[model samples]
Target: MPRPPARPRLTILDVARDAGVSKTSVSRYFGPERSLLSESMRTRIEASISRLGFYPDRIASSLRGRRTGLIGMLVADMRNPFTVAMIHGAEQACRARGYSLVVCNTDSDDLLEQRHLDVLQGYNVEGLVVNTRGHSVAPLVARFEAGLPMVMVDRHLPGLACDMVGLDNAQAMHLAMTHLAEQGYRKVLMVTPPIPGISSREERTACFESEALLSGLESELFEVDLDNEPARLGERLAGWLDEAPACRGAILTGNGVVNLAVCQALHQLMPAPLERTGLLGIDELEWCALVGPGISTVEQPVGAMGEEAIIRLLTRIEGDAEAPVHRTFEATLNVRGSTARVD
Candidate 1:
């Protein structure tokens, strides 16, 4: 005689029924706010859940739910290799903890960033790791203040406080500037993104300027919007080079994107019998070391930064968002042929 069909596998409701408690009580028992039930009741519910092999329907619960194991990452520009590497780090961390990541690109637009953030909230992501473009982040900050977890990477927002992981911008510049000076470069040009609002660029510019002044070396700044017109960089660089003819010196750039512009400018503006100009850049690029004169650089620990951002974001997700922490990895000054000593 065949045994009666096995009873349907137990679920949360079955566990609740066996434990003689409401489903809500069983949920409260397993959740953080565990004061709603007695120890005896909690134990009974736990035993029933274990014995019955019952698992909470996390997805459905998140639909009307509390704490979905999902995270949202907002990047200002997805094209940047540094940002892409950071995303890789975040993905590794998230996967390890059985969480999922949703990435959105805001293209440095405040409105787009806000819209993407709103969509994340609608999906009930447990946390957010953001690389905002310094737009209106007050609402996001307010949510963070009201207990939603957030961690910022790469760029810092003005007047908004959040846990952040990034490189020490000033230190990177100081190292690059000192390296250039040691190579006997008296006049230096710094190619950079727009300053004032862009924190990373601003910090780099400030440090370069201050260090140059301190060392009594004449330094010039050439700013460009690489994203808007990458090819137009040549024109801007040419103008800068034409104006500063005395500086047959090296050029230091803030990032890879700006470095491209600097190189293009050099290629276009230099008169026949091209002057041997030096080049240094922050944030290493794939082709940087391969080019002629091989770009000298202050290499940021991109992998480490990515890992740290995820680690910090997860920590905050686990109820540690209140205590603000800032971790900045030092940049390594890599001397290549670009900044070679002039005979």
Candidate 2:
């Protein structure tokens, strides 16, 4: 084999020389104090870094200071569209602030969640964004009490009292219920996953139950077992549809997962005609438009929620000692053919 040329070892010195600035200026450019530098100097340093492809060692930089420039995100289910969108927003915010994100998926498992927490802590991440399964809270509470900067996304941990960024569950349920009622859906069936420990699920379910009565729409709740016999979802859905008064019934899903399951059941029970039965869901999906009659959805501001979570976590990390804030963003309703009234 022919000998290959070795790549040049680039460093701060290289960047400084290339940018015609002192090493201190280059270092400050990468640090939080980059704002202290003139815009011209900052631009030159950025250009120099790009030209030389000189990547700073984050670990080495952390050794010189307390910040590791790493943010940790613990997600309950990475496969969910909402979670994926949130991660994208958080990652963008982190990068814009010159930080990196480390994400761990718990798969809705308590033990796995604890294990991921330990790993994130071991890596000394500057802050954490938790979208937990709400099954276990001991580890999370300990970390929060230990002065670790943390924010909860979508789901809340009992007794932890941390900042949370998520959708307004009450408003979301109200929107769904009101839409169904307006479309002349007098009877509603709300489908969701188990609602034992998850706060979001519980809140949405409770809201639906309470608001349904207030909206003057009779409502029934169904907890689908996604892991066990998912096919039974179709059976239960069929039963509900069969029992509901024709042209006066509708189905509302709690979240994206429930939406997917309900969608599956609807597909299996096709040719039954959805014109008489309306459908609406929280957390919009990409294929909602392609589905039968274009499934109606309450489009959550997922990206904004994620960005806000990062900003809040960073605030805590930067020594904001104020009381915990529970920020909830509103969801927008996207009406489509699914929720249209049948003649």
Pick the TM-score winner. Answer: 2
The clash count of every prediction, one per candidate, is: 1, 0
Residue-wise lDDT of candidate 1 within 34-80, one digit each (tens)?
A: 56678798899878887888876655778774766678899988988
Instruction: Give all candidates' CA lDDT scores.
Output: 0.77, 0.86
Residue-level lDDT tens digits of model 2 in 175-248: 88888888778888888888898888888899999999999988889887788878778888888767665638
- Identify the runs in model 2 with alpha carbons over 4 angstroms from their true place: 1-10, 32-43, 50-53, 245-247
For model 2, what is the error of residue 8's alpha carbon versus the real structure, in angstroms, after optimal superposition? 10
lDDT of 1 at 165: 89
Q: Clashes in candidate 1: how many?
A: 1
80: Cα error in model 2, Å? 0.2
lDDT at 87 for candidate 1? Answer: 91
Span of 10 residues, lowest total lDDT, candidate 2? 267-276
**Model 1 residue 19 lDDT score:** 90
Q: Residue 48 of model 2: what lDDT?
A: 92
